[model samples]
Target: MLIFKNLGEMASLEYLYKYDMYFAIFQLTFIALLGYIILSWLFRMWKQYKQLKNDKASAELALLKSKIDPHFFFNTLNNLYGLAIKKSDEAPQVILKLSEIMRYTIYEGENETVLLKDEINYLEQYIEVHKIRYKKTVNITFTKVIEEENISVAPLLFIMLLENAFKHGVESLTNNAYINLELIVKKKTLIFSVENNFEVKENAQTGIGIENLKRRLQLIYPKKHELLIHKDTSVYKTQLTIQLK
Candidate 1:
């Protein structure tokens, strides 16, 4: 039986090697190899495209975060310097708060997302640091209504809005300026609002911080978020909403 099988295989090979069958064999092999090459190339191209898109997003996020972390820290340093110049007694407290803020900046800032409680604590630290720096009472308040526990959010997401509040709102007025922040968390929604009263400027343009925040939101949250801004002669308001699971 083995001898018969060997004889049949050889006969089939001999028929295939016949001169008249050469073109047919070549054509079949060519088509099969071409199909394989085309499939391989398409797969490679698809993989590269996916990789490139992911890398681009990662790099842009890193760049936006870099822009943010330094901007606020440097401004805080300036406040510290001001206190140092005046030899203010609260300088020590400010220094301690700033150190804690720096610790968060160095460690937690690198994470893609963090606990909602931790994020709120980070914001409070910023507020406390500024409160220590301010010479007069600026009337700052933070109100929250969260129905969820152990929520997670993108880190450093709201600091730019807070920074903008302080820069354009709190700093422009001589007195009677106020900054109000509100946070609401539902089962699948998060809303954060910042409102402040400021002296109107002659022709103030939007700053880089807000623009940076906008871009970051586009990258991180995409269609899952909303940023609303309203400004008038006396008040500037920003509300950000994110749909989270």
Candidate 2:
């Protein structure tokens, strides 16, 4: 106030002295603000780093999962062709169902996520067609413990697992073969459990289906999903649990 009241060189000296004491304070404040900005920028960079990692993993997993559809469709079509060549009475209905499965597998299966209930319906339809194709030899038992209206899941994820269970389990059975599915939704998590009976073969293999399912889970849910598979002398059991996002 005294510096502002006076004029000339005397006032200039007084004003400079007064604010000189605050010079260090202003420098410190500027430094603090700059540090804060740098820290915020680093935090944003770290978050982007994490997101990029997740995206890369997802892209790789999507590529792996994309491989599954071709193999699956090829095998299914081969199976259907065999049925056609046999001149079976159920061939017409089998073709219609195949068309539906193809549509779903090609179109809906490409999505990142889908209603869990819809995927389940697609699986049931596919299994039914397969049951018709393999009617004489395979016995399938499917049980649903979760209401389909309440849940959603990553699209086409569980189908490959189910397909593998049936392929290996059904192919090895001489008679009385059964595949059982139980879906349980508890709180915010969903548990899908499948068990199938199969004869012990010398050349049993865990094919591309299992690998694809693993990659899909890692990409889609990462630490939020759990997959467990148990193979005993005669029964193979698989359980996948995912925390709904």
Candidate 3:
């Protein structure tokens, strides 16, 4: 009877030890599983955070570009009205040209990018109107070295610089000031250079348009473009180069 009791006790103790070992393993496994779940949730949250940040950036960029369009449209319309009031006889033809530009500015300008041909045509019409406005005082030349007509570019980019050249370049001309515009496309790069001769007084200020233009460029192209402005003696020069992807 004693021997039987001792064997029974030893067996019970051994069973307890095995049960304890199993319980310890279960606890460790539960802890490890919980830690894995927590780490997985954190990783998912990080991904979501990055995605939201990118979305917000994209939204902000779209809003900024939207703001720029209205400012540009308002300015162009004001200029057109001034021309119409001054030159009533040519107002009809000017209205036609203005309509084309308005169509493009309203519809196409809202897009992220536009066909290069459309931009070229829009600029041509704008220059034609300017020619009518300042016929005798302003001399304008446009040169292009593009091999293809189906290229795409960011909208209203070059026009901003062109408009600035007209606004600030010719106001100080004594005889006849000239604006030379050039566009060159080679491989994957598009280059624009505008040179204007002007008389500079002591105090000269570049207005909101230029600043707004710079902001637009930064938002759209980021690191894909370069803009250079130089004033030497009596001439002002602006050069812009952008890589088209």
- Regions of candidate 3 where Cα sits further than 4 Å from its true position: 1-89
Model 2 residue runs over 4 Å out of place are 1-19, 69-72
lDDT at residue 28 of model 1 (Cα atoms): 92
Q: What is the lDDT of residue 138 in candidate 1?
A: 95
TM-score of each: 0.82, 0.81, 0.75
Residue pairs in steric clash, candidate 3? none
Candidate 1 per-residue C-alpha lDDT over 137-190 given as tens digits, one digit per residue, 9 for 90 to 100: 899999999998999999888888998898888878889989999999987899
Q: What is candidate 3's lDDT per residue for 150-193, written digit by digit as tens? A: 89987888887787777777756756889999999998899999
Model 1 alpha-carbon drift over 4 Å, by segment = 1-33, 69-75, 82-88, 203-205
**Model 2 agreement with the true structure over 154-227: per-residue lDDT tens digits:** 78877877887777888778788888888787677898888998887887676788878887787778799999
Assess the local accuracy of residue 96 in candidate 2 as a C-alpha lDDT between 0 and 100.
84
RMSD of 2: 4.2
Worst 10 residues of 3 by lDDT: 64-73
The residue-level lDDT of candidate 3 at 81 comes to 80
Candidate 3 yields a Cα-based lDDT of 0.80
Clashes of each: 0, 0, 0
